[model samples]
Target: MAARRKPALICCGAALAAAVVLAAVFTALYFTVLRPRPPRVTATVVGTRVSAFALIPSPALNLTFDVAVAAYNPNRAAFEYGEVVTVVRYHGDAVGEAVVPRGEVGARASAEVRAVVEVDAVEVFSSPYFPLEGIAGALPFETATTVAGKAVVLGVLKIRASSVVTCGVTVYPLRKETTSPQCTSTVHVG
Candidate 1:
């Protein structure tokens, strides 16, 4: 009877030890692996709106535009706003880059800064002959020659900021606006 009791107690202890080890391992994994990731960067636009464009061309291609974007710092720290370059991409090709003036708006208390997009004399490369990547993209308004086309300026929103946060693996979609060079953006966001 004593021997049987001893074996039973040993078996129970072994099982309990394994259970304890498993629990510790699982707890470590959860804390390290299952934690929610932080947002490293965010972007938006402020003072965005639409407007009609009519320039030096006598018979202008009737084109309207909507422009807006906001830049955000998705970390818990404050970042210095560097050169805010806004590039316009059409059909996976770069059409133009707008230099956003620094000191637009930045705050450490808030992890967001309002960026203003000031575009000038941008042309629409909507015609096949005037591909967004060709000279026709940035056409000369003084020239009477016209090439009808459809182009969208995809705003590549990027900032020269730094942070230690690790954002989740998600697609930060490219924001854009469709407008003639004569038009500008006056969009806003919080």
Candidate 2:
């Protein structure tokens, strides 16, 4: 009778141990995978420095606008960004392109990006609505940008994500600044 009782106690202990292990695994999954959160991103035109030029033969105008971009991560885990691409357009013409340097944003942190964009006169003039005569004055422009990256959730799960931002701004090339640009942004997680 004593020997039978010992076997039964050992079997119960083993079952309890297995249950505890399974519970721990489920808790970890819930925190990392099931409840993963996306990072937050923001962009502002802190400074828009512009330089303009005009060709002698062609009526085209060239310009360069240096822009600043910022991103904030509001997650509990670190957000690592891959590549950030920014395209600047005048009217509908693509005038400049920029690739922001990629880096990691610590949990609940922010990152700043610098982009120097060069736009040729031909591209701006190609737009039917672009005022070629008033090339020396303020110009309406649009900036479309994307940031692709991955987030580490709970130090275990890594999720891929992307952030897109489009902005329409009126820039005064002569003043070298933007006049209140309107921006729309979205985040996609996978």
Best by lDDT: 2
lDDT of 1 by residue, 90-154 (tens): 33334334453443233223333333332232344353533332322233221010111111112
In model 1, state the lDDT of residue 105. Answer: 30
Going through the candidates in order, what is the number of backbone clashes in each? 18, 1
After superposing candidate 1, which stretches have Cα over 4 Å from the reference?
1-39, 45-50, 53-77, 93-96, 102-108, 116-122, 126-190
> 94-132, model 2: which lDDT tens digit per residue?
888988778898877888887777776677767676665
TM-score of 2: 0.75
Candidate 2 regions with alpha-carbon error over 4 angstroms: 1-29, 32-35, 53-62, 132-138, 174-177
Candidate 2: C-alpha lDDT: 0.74
Per-candidate Cα lDDT values, in order, are 0.34, 0.74
What are the root-mean-square deviations of the candidates from the true structure over C-alphas? 15.2, 3.8
